[model samples]
Target: MTTTELAPETTGAPTRPGLTPAGLVTVLLGAALPIIDFFIVNVALPTIDADLHASTATLELVVAAYGIAYAVLLVVGGRLGDSFGRRRLFVTGLWLFTLTSLACGIAPTAGTLVVARAAQGAASALLLPQVLSIIQATTSGEKRSRALGLFGATGGISSVVGQLLGGGLVAADLWGTGWRPIFLVNVPIGLVVLVMARKLPESRAHNPLGVDRLGTALLAVTLLSLLIPLMEGRALGWPVWSIALLIVSPVAAVAFVHVERRLERNGGTPLLPPSVMRLPSVRRGLMVAVPFFGAFGSFMFVFAMTLQEGLHFGPLGAGGALTPLAVAYFTVSMLSSRLVARYGQKVVPLGGAITATGMVALLCTTLSAWPHVTILELAPSMVAIGVGNALAMTTLFRIVLSHVPTDLAGVGSGVMTTNQQTSLALGVATLGSLYAALSASLGSRDAFALVIGAVAVLAAIVAITGRRLPDPRA
Candidate 1:
């Protein structure tokens, strides 16, 4: 089916205003918060365990709960934004995020903190999709391109910044709060964003589809069955339930597809329309997104462990080590639009090649230096990886959403974000588990090298498949 057939009717809402410079900043800030929160806890995990007496299993939940909730609800959040109003949901989400952050900060028990983190994840789901949806609906031509570039940069920078900020906050332990401040810091920032969000011009699908209850439930089950097992299986020793959930995941996924298709056939709006999935840009873009983001997630998780556990780096030291990566990613991402305009689709494969080269450098460094490696030793490889990632990711975002009709902007954004989020969870689960298991047999240095090698292979796959993406300008 063509996008025109799938476009929602424009009957209720009046014409929406274009996004202003200030509005772009407001939405981008909204986008950054959830992504930053996802990685921020990595540096603070040890402190959280010590302070709350959290068990290893419970500690995994601290991360997994947020991710699972965030990933599962993301598409639903987008649909809600399209149905209601993007600005309204954005503001409400910020309010809830602030309160949930406070809840996380003050929780006395590990269980309470886990629950609060899940709520915080839910709040994030409500907020993030609007960032892209608003930009898609309100901006066009060069303005849209630049806005998307900034959005991509925000996401990439936020992931690194999350770790950096987590380390800084945990080390400072302001007012004797220890790890609490990592979450508490969001309270004030969220409030300030809430005020700024007032300036965001509201937009929604003119004839938005009602939420698809069955499709939502099936999608949640599909994700939970898969993610819960991967995230918790390694820590919990691959229990029977974990294996069972893995089996159920594919079954639930098949059912989800059947349900969504049937809904669309019957003239109802499905949660994720098959038409969107059939779009070549969406399909090809996702092929790259899966491996690219999977590697990204695993690299962040495994490298943090390697630094702290192997090299005995403090939180500050570990976070500081990634400084080169953050710098390169921001610098390159800012320049990516112009690069895409000049180089077209060639940029992604070139990025993949560069990323593989960087990973290989990292692998060699780990093998040669072992536990003696320092931040300076890792800087060159990190810089290479960051530059390549910016090229691929920034371009991929533009390519994926470029063809989406404005009427389906929320759905398209949701589909892309959900794919990205799910891949991240899978990467951390699979590669992270591989690293842990290998560390015992191969030793930390070899295990890390082996994982980096695997990541390099994933980057190679991205380079190969990136050739298939249609250039947005075409």
Candidate 2:
């Protein structure tokens, strides 16, 4: 009855209807917007602070709220898509995202914007999982790998573009508008995606499970218990409530797993299928994803803060600094699928090594130049990280869901994305907290060097851990 003694499941050839040229575009476009929006606000946060005279706490909420809501809802959203139809949920989510974007753009106060960001995050939670589910349900083998590659590539491209665009839009100060354009710009893109979605294929779980209301509620509470404390504890100076919540988080997590197991044992539906957790592909892949994305999320937030506040760089300057990273990611990711096919999961460790080297270079450069670092000095390291990430992302995604059954595509995709999103939030919370605490006394440059050096160390761990990934070629 041991895990190793269990027989492997083989799915010979992909039999499902394939993704069309236009349909692939639709889902990926749907994916790109939310991801771009996720970090687009990073460069714009300073502008928002000045415009609304918002406190540091509220600004942190502006970013944390969206990430938290998105992470919490993703699994349930994926389950809903399985039962009700992915296309329907995707369209609905897109419309909601579009409307919320408009709301964010027009908000008159920081509080209103914060609420809008939360709503937008919820919409994103609905939209994003379907993209993965659809691909999982439809494509298989090399096609699945390629589609997922594009999705990961989209992640890199959109994030950099978001930062770049946010800086440009804020600088343009078009019609005297400032950071509003970052959110407002999504309206048109959402419209195009919605239009394209009409032509996309409609697919869902062939044997869809009913909604697990209890499990859903428990999952949300568990994530919130962890997320709220980590995100707020530092800014609030680690209040008693924050400490209490942090202590409760592991208990809630345990409860969640227990309840889910009981539900599955009783033959009732569960949010996280216990059988899925038994899959090494799913379980171990999660271990790799959490740390990798945690590093990425924290790096984005910390670097953005350092770039603008510490270096006194304009939004444009900060955005431009990441261009090399974006270029390298897009270029390398395009080839990662082939590499994944050739080398299997080894690409992930290789990527982690390269990215770690890049981080080390960045840390050294920052220390050497102090606050006077230029874009030219930063480019090589940025590109190295980009290349490393590109290799890992596409391959890791393929490996994570490599063994998921077609009938459980929604659930599996949901689980992967939920981990991905939650890890990002954790990254922001932990790394960001460390940076904020260190910045209180140390010079910003020194603090940044240490934190980024930590990020490099994180990458190294992920690389070492990545050797455990299920070899797709096996």
Candidate 3:
């Protein structure tokens, strides 16, 4: 294809050389850190509560604060990268993340840790969008497909590794550090990545637009209104304020959309351009992303609880139980590009079907074995789900970005990541809440089985939706 047809943002030769092998590795390393941190705290929460004497509500805030801050600022972070420089923002974000992690490690009180965690989330917001934007801007054709596939694999594996690493760190309690090591460990790794990041090439929009302050405000308000309540409501006994915020969420969302559309029509850049959202590929890919990621997030949360609370396994054992899943996801993700090239869009629905089958099998196994179920028994189903997730998500990333122009890479990445992150939080809120509520009445085994069954339904929805996605190659 001609340059004009390939990327309207450029004319003549491309402005910069493609990303080097070292640069690809650097960006992918940066990408994995934020996702790992998100899940690493799951196994550390109890230890933190005990060490800091935090109330149950405060413990929840440790997780919610990070999530809310990260989700709220993501698009703005992406915009900043596009307007300034992706490399500049990436370095800045990594620096901030390192400092905040130190703060979290040494936090003297519960309130201090909560604030530090929120700041860490903000740093993550600044860091993550740049990874996807960089990949989009710096690679193409088979190389692009391969890079995106690796990125997908990194994300899937990081979630599982986070908990596993967290458990190991907490169990080791290096020098009696207890849960502090989880956050502290990021410091050395972040510093190392910052040094390596110098190899990365900087890329940004050729005609960058000014930040949309109104759009930013509205989007933040919308997300905070929805996410905060869902994240904290059940834990706080569904207080009046939480209920009120939930009521306000949709109104803010509607206003945000209206303002964005108006800005685009008036010949101005909005935080999220309606033009990008209108792409058939972007639209369809995101529709499937919601349920697929939702199921993934909720399964991780609930299964962690099942292993620890129901089976009375320690943190290490609980995290280790997921090994089969992680291995399968990584192995499959490595080969997904070739699979997609051969099968086209058909791979996505097939992945969803496999995921649903795995979930059903898991449910059956849980119901039959109940309290006696072992990791060995869970391995087969976990592998199936992992393989399915690898196939679906790796291709889904390609499908979403397939039609986006280079000038809009940051916006597109921001939009996709925001959708994925929001869906994950919602999944944890909705299905996690269901499991908690039901476990009280129906018992843990039955409650878990019911929730897994729901996840199967979600996978089936993904299967149905996947059929509508256009092939990325086309």
Candidate 4:
């Protein structure tokens, strides 16, 4: 696969309505909703627990269940979009997400809410893959770069906005529904998205491959086994089943690899095309994405809790605190394309080092201020983190998708999205669990800062390693 050979496969034209700025905004909004929902719920969870009287284990499940289901099914969702139509899947997923969100809002018990959240995650999986695929299949050059940058910004911005808005909704208890408002708020927005999506052109692979049922199941099982225990085990005191599940994760994952290999060798479409795994750019990019997203997930989850439970900030306060991050992320993300073009791959590692510095600053500030610090005090560090995230996050997306062939765009998008979702879930589970465990001994606030700071350092290491990867051009 030389550069010339890959060049033809990368060219694409934007869909009819999607070619316009309004169309781009519509598509981006549809894409942003799902990502936003994933993180927004973190802030509202405490409110849900208090209002609904849900236990800690159930609350953990509420978050983890959604994340795991979304991660597992994302590849399948991408394939479905390819076989059917990206526009079709987008509309269907959005409607389902809206409905499920309503169910989540109205649920009377913790179990029901968790189930609804899982359904929401599944709908999200269906909706999200098509976003990148649509962008890949429908746009090229400056248009592609701009759309991708918006996607990157949306991802980082949503995490911050989700927390902020979730806090506002829960606190305002709009229409006196308390935490229910958080879920119900999506309905009107979904309806608008549905209409806009219908006007958007449909796109799909000319010759779509059949779904890989076995690979999908195995991937789901592997992720669930690994993620479930990590998220729930600590809160539940490390139960026997949790430990057992952790032990079984590797076995399940190994089994999955074997199954995928057999499928590929036999000429069947595996969940992820095996050829993708062999691509140097794809492989290295995934390696970089995993720890990066994992740390990201853990950071959002822990920070949400730290503000609410540890620092006793109100919903508005917690959400408001993240504003600096959102601003910084968007500002710096806009500059990432130019940076990558000029600086090449080194920009990513630079982003990581800057992010590391921000985290270190935050940790120091938090440790010194303890229970007395306000959002204003955290603003400077938050802005730095946001700037760092903006640079690294956008670069990561571009790097991963940079060399993918348009023919296999669907699966390629799926692979990258699944890696992201899984890492995010794992981050929340593993790093979140670490924070929870350490909080018991070190006090909640300090424990969270310490754990998050450590994870950020590790993410910096991953970024530095990514700098060594051969550029797609190379």
lDDT of each: 0.80, 0.79, 0.79, 0.76
* lDDT tens digits by residue: candidate 4, 346-386: 77788777778888888878889988878988999899888
lDDT of 2 by residue, 65-168 (tens): 78777866777677677678778999999999999999999999998998999899899878877887777666778888888677767877787777688889
- 106 in model 3: Cα distance from truth in Å? 3.6
Q: Would you estimate the TM-scores of all the predictions?
A: 0.88, 0.88, 0.87, 0.89
The deviation in Å at residue 59 for candidate 3 is: 5.8
Q: Give the range where candidate 1 is weakest over 10 consecutive residues by summed lDDT.
A: 1-10
What stretches of model 1 exceed 4 Å from their correct place? 1-25, 49-61, 108-112, 133-153, 156-160, 196-204, 440-442
Error of 4 at 135 (Å): 5.0
Cα RMSD of all models vs. native, in order, equals 4.1, 4.8, 4.3, 4.0
RMSD of 3: 4.3
lDDT per residue (tens digit) for residues 115-217 in model 1: 9988998888888767777777787789978987777678777877887898899888899999898889899999999999888888887666688889878
Off by over 4 Å in 3: 1-26, 45-65, 107-114, 132-160, 196-204
Q: Tell me how far candidate 1 lies from the true structure as C-alpha RMSD in angstroms.
A: 4.1
Candidate 3's TM-score: 0.87
User: Any runs in candidate 2 off by more than 4 Å, and if so which?
Assistant: 1-25, 54-57, 132-153, 195-205
